[model samples]
Target: MDEAIIAKGLYKRYKRVQALRGVTFKVPRGRVFGLLGPNGAGKSTTIKILVGLIKPDKGEALIFGKRAGSTGAKSLLGYAPERFSIGNNWRLIDFLVYVGRLHGLSERLAAERALYLLEWAGLGGYEEEKFGNLSAGMKKRFGLVQALISDPEILILDEPTEHLDAIGRLEVLNRIRELASRGKTILLSTHVLAEADYVVDSFAIMNRGRIIYHGSRLDVQGVVRIVVDKPAEFEKALHRAGLEYSISGNEFIVETSGVEDEKLVLRICLDNNIRVIRYDTSSSISDIFMRIVGAEKR
Candidate 1:
């Protein structure tokens, strides 16, 4: 199947709070799909449904054509929740092996896989460390290691880098990129758009329990930035052409559809004797996120 996960018109209400409102999106196979939004945006709720932790009050979710939360679907997936609890007494290696066994691995194989993964995740010599003894960053990485024990085809990570320092966040993100390179489909949910900016192939922004925008990262509509030597003439020309734009010093940012619109801007500048010093398309992920969610709020 081309789509790895599909949420179809999902709706869920808890007491007086509506967690999901006809939420819908698809995660394509072998690609990183980011579910981004602020807190209370229902990102967690949608992730829960995908991982079979909770059943939606209405609509359905599918995992490779299998009903979400079904045995078949669960077997092919790995999950790392934003917050998880483990006994303080449990040893890191033992916990991972136990989880591997539950997934049907032989005892010996489970131990072997656990050790390999722990080392790969930078926890090599800490196999015997108690769960509560590890540092916060190590604990988070351990959670990720355990989820990967069964070598799942799909990974669902909820706020994987939350509360981590800059370095910790980078380490976790690099691991995610490596997994994607190995052809594993990932559904990463986070409030920080910058965390997923470099890795995500496509994304959906959620707010108020609904998706405000969904599109490929490359297709995100960012402003066209132009640097001109004749700032006054350029500004006047833009005003005459009735184009929506913003100016800061010598740079002019014009919102445009594509190359055609860029060409139009260029022609306008040329006609007005406005020397175009530089022209480019540049916008950060956070910029795109704010634009989309802000518009939804209005």
Candidate 2:
């Protein structure tokens, strides 16, 4: 896949606070890469630099192999900011058309794109509805349509489902996954861990403007745990099989190096006649994310 985005030694500062400190990473073409960070950790700042909305104090950002801010590169991507603020008085369909036209489409083409996106976003009959009258969830759906009207090859979304309810979150996440499966490159920035795990093919964890981890899903598949009673006996069972284990209360975390180790653990437990109260595997993308992203002091 062709490279969709690249950044090197990027830095930004805002009057006493260094928002970004030499951040750098790349997103491959036709994959969803999640940019994850805690609040004020520079997730939004890195996004701003990548989209050319704000200049970086140092280093470079590239989109579609072209430098960010280049006229030739600007049209290849769509952006959805963290906040949703649009013309409240305009009809949903009309607003999308206006956005499309600004991206270089003719009026008729813009209108066509607008209608298509509105319907795709589940706002088919509500196209003629006033934006201000729509509920918060509906407004977000409309905002999504605005971002997608240009049919961009790369999508840069900042907190796309922030502050939404369960249904709304699922709605947006499903749409994001659908877009990626269609071979579009997505650079997703969000503080929501569970949803990002579902949509992203890879991850880049940022902390106060620095890139700490950048890798594929397999990289995060370390040992994870599910707690149950009688962990001591379980620990000894694993020990007999030459597998190491750690413990926290009744919860025992056994490290299964790979698929073979995982199977070995299950077999040993079954053979011991242990009353498998609750057996489960360890290690998940979310576990790795939380551990590294929320590192503590010694």
For model 2, the run of ten residues with the poorest summed lDDT? 221-230
Provide the lDDT at 167 for model 2: 98
lDDT of 1 by residue, 56-99 (tens): 99999999999999989998899999975589999998999899
Q: lDDT of model 1 at residue 281?
A: 77
lDDT of 2 by residue, 49-158 (tens): 88888999999999977888777677888888888777789988788877788898999999988888888999888888988898888777776778789999888889
Q: Estimate candidate 2's RMSD in Å.
A: 2.8
User: What are the lDDT figures for the candidates, one per model?
Assistant: 0.89, 0.82
Q: What lDDT does model 1 reach?
A: 0.89
Estimate candidate 1's RMSD in Å. 2.3
